[model samples]
Target: MDELEFRRQLYTNPRNRSEALLQEARRNNKNKKLYDDMQQLENKLEQALNVEVPDGLAERLMLRQSFDDSRQQYRRKSRWQIAIAASIAFALGLSTSLFHWQQQAADMGQLALQHVYEEMPYTSGVDEQPSLQTINAKLARYGASFEQLPGKVVYVNHCAYAGSPALHMVMKGKMGSNINVFVVPKSTELKTVQSFSDKTLHGMVEPLANASLVVVGEMKEPIEKTLHTLTAELNQAI
Candidate 1:
């Protein structure tokens, strides 16, 4: 047989013509080498393709052809079943991962808000009436160097900022406006300004030399003026 017919016989049905050809070649001494070379080439091709020429596979194919029945129905059914099962498993895994991510995000948000509320100065009892001298003295240690702006210093205490001890003072401004100042020594004053507002009060921040000053009050204009004057005084002291 020609090369194409020989290959087709080996792939389509190896049991029938392949063995018969080998037996015929062995009977004919002239074709014995050709038959041995063909067998070796076929073995090499099978190894390269990683396909085992099962003895039963060719028998089953011939039997099915003779019976005229569909032989690949079971394989097609198995493939479809495996595909559907894989899709369902992937969807379930994806949903579980998304749910876990969302839960972690919500927990992180609550933790962040709680930490921020704890660090805020307005939430503490620092506004209660305290000794003014003690407060000013503590502020002086943090480089406040105050000249006592015309007001009754009613509240004085040290507050924590970013794990460092800072000064917090509440002095009665003109017209019953309370001036709350926060001083941090290690932080350098920058030109940036920011505002914060709670339900009951509003506050502004300003930079001072080697420190940051924040004043929380109800009126904006008076607080701004006080912050500007305090910033100038604190800068001169440094």
Candidate 2:
């Protein structure tokens, strides 16, 4: 597995003993060390959770189990109780793993990319553009608005960003390329333009007033120009 996938797996489940993962770990000294370190941490955590039984609890339990019927029924009940406890523990562990992974996977740029493409095919550019009022209502939630859009406002709706629903817009670019705008109310820790590109899409994240705008589209589009226009209009609105 690649480093990102390997690290994610390690973070989620250090106790995992998959042969393929073991082989991947063994391929490089650094990877092996990383795996070993994670495993060591897991061991230490498990050790920390180990508890000693009370001194007289074992003898009292033995006396209770001395009777034949009680012993047999208690044995059956003990098994069932242990089984249910293990199932619950397993579920809790799985849920914790998923939540941890989701927290680690919080990158709004990637979220914007996925949302943009997922809606691209099903929704086309402005057959009948959304009214400015509709767009502003959604944008207002984030303290941003479009008094006048830079381009045709083909689609406008709300989509999730970091588990919270935010404004989503699809605008037709000057080059006829469709631009996706995701405006989420957030305070970015860094104050710089973040750009991303892939085989089929490219985009940049622009920090805004109490929010961020993610603009994405095909490579040929004048993405930078669109961004400037959008930013200017948004600044005026604020």
Candidate 3:
């Protein structure tokens, strides 16, 4: 098998043990890496598909079977029904996993941008507006600190992002709009400058070693320039 054939087999049935495909994959460096990555995904899918069986489930299922002719007919249908239930469960699990994985891959920056406005309703609380000391204190937990902000700090609060605890804040921007900054610690972020936008909000995510610094503001605002200056100040403080 050539590289394409080997890859086709890997994609379709990564567990295949055909010597020809396996030999070709091992011999080609590129094919080996592709095979490994695909295999890892396949393994994850397999693990996700696995369902835990209740204790004595097999015994309970067998107990429902009997040898009578009329009962045997029903028994056959029961077995078929059980198989269908298992298949449906497996299909649902796979679909849910795939949905979340696909969502996480598509437009992470856009999600950060949306989060800013989504939390606006709760902005009126007395403690919602926090001081610079409070902001840097939260940052210091993730091995980062800011002696000064690019603009006036208008709001600061500890919020949740992607099901994890994160530091959420807002700063005054040049265009009379508040910039939302969500800092998430011990979370995954893109290791590059990723920009995202919507009709009302625009944002970027800067991946850091211990946290992700996400910034969002109005679409017409100077995002790149402001982010650069803010990041520089943050680095200096650190």
Candidate of highest lDDT: 2
lDDT (0-100) at residue 29 of candidate 2?
Answer: 98
TM-score of each: 0.40, 0.57, 0.57
lDDT of each: 0.54, 0.72, 0.68
lDDT of 1 by residue, 64-174 (tens): 233333658755544555555555666898799987655543332222223234434443433445554555567666665655542456665665443356666666665
Backbone Cα, N, C clashes tallied per candidate: 0, 0, 0
RMSD in Å for candidate 2, one decimal? Answer: 15.7
For all predictions, the C-alpha RMSD in Å is: 32.5, 15.7, 17.9
Q: Which residue runs of candidate 1 sit more than 4 Å off their true CA positions?
A: 1-133, 175-177, 188-192, 219-221, 232-237
| Tens digits of lDDT, candidate 2, 104-207 | 44666666677676566545634447787887887777887766866787777776555666777888888887888888777442233499877888899888
| Model 2 TM-score, 2 decimals | 0.57
In candidate 2, stretches whose alpha carbon ends up further than 4 angstroms from where it belongs are 1-85, 187-193, 236-238
- TM-score for model 1? 0.40
List clashing residue pairs in candidate 3: none
